[model samples]
Target: MSNIVIYHNPKCGTSRNTLALIRHAGLEPTVVEYLKTPLGKEELRALVAATGEPVRALLRAKESQATELGLNDPTVSDEALLDAMAAHPILMNRPVVVTPLGTALCRPSERVLELLPVGPLPPFTKEDGEVVNDSGARRA
Candidate 1:
C-alpha cells in the first residue's frame, strides 16, 4: 500500500479536486471511498489522530443528522462524535489526506499539498479557480 491515503467522496468537488492535485503532484494515492467503505471506529480514530485535529473538527456539523443527533452541542464528547461518525459516515468531513508529511482535512483541496512528498509540483488550480503554484504557494 502507498503511504498516501485519501478518504474520498467522488461526488464532492473538493474531494475530486484534491485527488486531482495528488495525481498532478505525481503520486497515485490509495483512495478510500469512505461513504462506500465506511470507516470503522479504529480507522476513524486513527485518521483523526493522524490529523492531530480535535475529533469535533473531523465532524461535519452541517450534516443534517448532526443537529438531529444533538452533535451540535459543545458538551458532546469525542467518543460520541466518533461513534456518530462511524455510524453515519456523512457526519465525517470529506477529502482527508494522509501521507508521510502528515494528515490534513483538505477542505480547500490545496491543503493536500502539505501531506505530499517534496518534489516539483505541477501547476494546480482548485475547482474554484484558485491557483497553487509549483512551490505550493497560492498564487494571487
Candidate 2:
C-alpha cells in the first residue's frame, strides 16, 4: 500500500497537478476520487482533522451547494459541516494530501510538496504555465 493518500478530483487542475508533483517525487500515492466514492461522516471528520485546519476551512465555498445547503454560513456547526461534506463530496476542497509528514489542503497544488518526503523536488510547470523549481519556489 502507498504511504501517501491524495483526495483527488479529476476535473480539478490543482488536483491533477498535485498528483503530478507526487509522481515527480517518485512516490505513487493512493488517489481517492472523492466525488465518485463519497466519504462517510467519520472519514470526513478524520480527513478534516488531519489537515490541521478548522472544519469550515476545508469547505469548497465555490460550489453552489455550499450556499444552497447553508454550509457557507459561519454559524454552521462543525458537525453539520461534516455532514454536508459527507452528503456532497464536492463540498470539500480538492487535493487534500495525507503523507507521513502531514496532511494539507493543496490549494495551490505545490503545497503537496510539504507532505512529500524531505528531499529535492524536481522542477515542475503547472498547466497554467507556472513553474515550480526544485526548492519548491517559482522559477521565472
lDDT of 2 at 37: 91
Candidate 1 structure quality by residue, lDDT tens digits, 1-140: 78889999998999999999999887899999999999998899999998889999999999899999999999999999999999999889988998877788998887777667865586788778888776654312
Q: How accurate locally is residue 35 in candidate 2, as Cα lDDT from 0 to 100?
A: 93
lDDT by candidate, in order shown: 0.88, 0.87
Can you tell me which runs of candidate 1 are displaced by over 4 Å? 136-140
Estimate, for each residue in 1-140, the C-alpha lDDT of model 2 and write its tens digit. 99999999999999999999899889999999999999999998998888879999889988999999987778999999999999888998988998888889998898877678755775888989999876643212
For each candidate, C-alpha RMSD in Å? 3.2, 3.5
Question: Which ranges of candidate 2 are over 4 A from the true structure?
Answer: 136-140
lDDT agreement of model 1 with the native: 0.88
Q: What lDDT is obtained when candidate 2 is compared to the true structure?
A: 0.87
